[model samples]
Target: MGRSPCCEKAHTNKGAWTKEEDQRLVAYINAHGEGCWRSLPKAAGLLRCGKSCRLRWINYLRPDLKRGNFTEEEDALIIHLHALLGNKWSLIAGRLPGRTDNEIKNHWNTHIKRKLLSKGVDPITHRPIDATDCERSEEKKAPRCPDLNLELCMDLPIEMQQEPECSVVPSSTTFLLLDYCRTSLQMN
Candidate 1:
């Protein structure tokens, strides 16, 4: 089978996009909005391939992009959304207005991971997935549910147990049920 070519070769006086090239790409996009990325390079008359052009436009050239550091609310949103959605960056980006998937992913890796690690939590599992937390939580749970099995976990609804966004619900309602599960089951 023919393998996919490694993305439109680089460093041929093409890696560093010039202002003139950016202008051409922007103008072309404005005149005729983005479509058929594979044909974009030929149509735009740029030395770069379609993929490169697309990355540049989406990541940097887009006028709607919100640049600079993320705010505290944005950070909370990321953590909250991550706990709910896992690593669905695209989905998370959809919730935050003006944020791009790339930006969100970078923020998650560089900043979020560091914070979680410091808090004695695993970045991947998010639920104390680190070795120490894993051992400790496991030990804590073992005494409580010596007979618990995968079947029980499988029977539970994901929204009820794991989805972080569900925390938004008022505590006066079914949230007490959630709290009950946390205390009784030690899920947190």
Candidate 2:
């Protein structure tokens, strides 16, 4: 089942918080302590939901919150964390003091992803883009079977296994190469 509601939605304020509301939330947290997010709004005398209060406190009102554009060091650190963590933004944010997961996620989407693409790096794989043009974002992906598990092994006949006396490749090797090219062409 879905989670029980956090609050009576009809009674809670939505959208942006006013400066007075912000002050009240900050004051209340200063007076008390953090956690008990579900009880924060009522205790703070704010007309917002607990989640709304918690997000506002964490994303905006926290005393140590970092503002303005991220520095070059921060940018590189974010990219490295994203490479290791994928879309686990909360985990990535935990390493960055005072930066929210939402902030990191937004920055990645708006800026870092584009930067990686410009440098010929695959943002998803965190590697150089293949020269085959197979991994570019603009290209449509090849169709795949859900249950497919492919394994390729090269096992040549004894006659073909030995290096050819002359420069010409054996028929079996040529045939195998042709099949590979045909399969790849079909996928594209």
Per lDDT, the best of the predicted structures is: 2
- Candidate 1: residue pairs that collide: 84-164
For candidate 2, which ten residues in a row score worst on lDDT? 143-152
TM per candidate comes to: 0.62, 0.68
Give the alpha carbon lDDT tens digit for every residue of 37-142 in model 2.
8988898898888988888888899999899888888889999988787899999999989788999999999999999999998888787776754543223233
Report the poorest 10 consecutive residues by lDDT, candidate 1. Answer: 146-155
**Cα lDDT tens digits for candidate 1, 1-188:** 99675345763245588899999999999999999776787788877777888899998888888989999899989998998898899999999988999999999999988998898776766666447645654654453333332211222363354431212334454455555555767754
lDDT of 2: 0.79
Off by over 4 Å in 1: 1-13, 128-188
Largest TM-score belongs to which candidate? 2
In candidate 2, list every pair of residues with a backbone clash. none
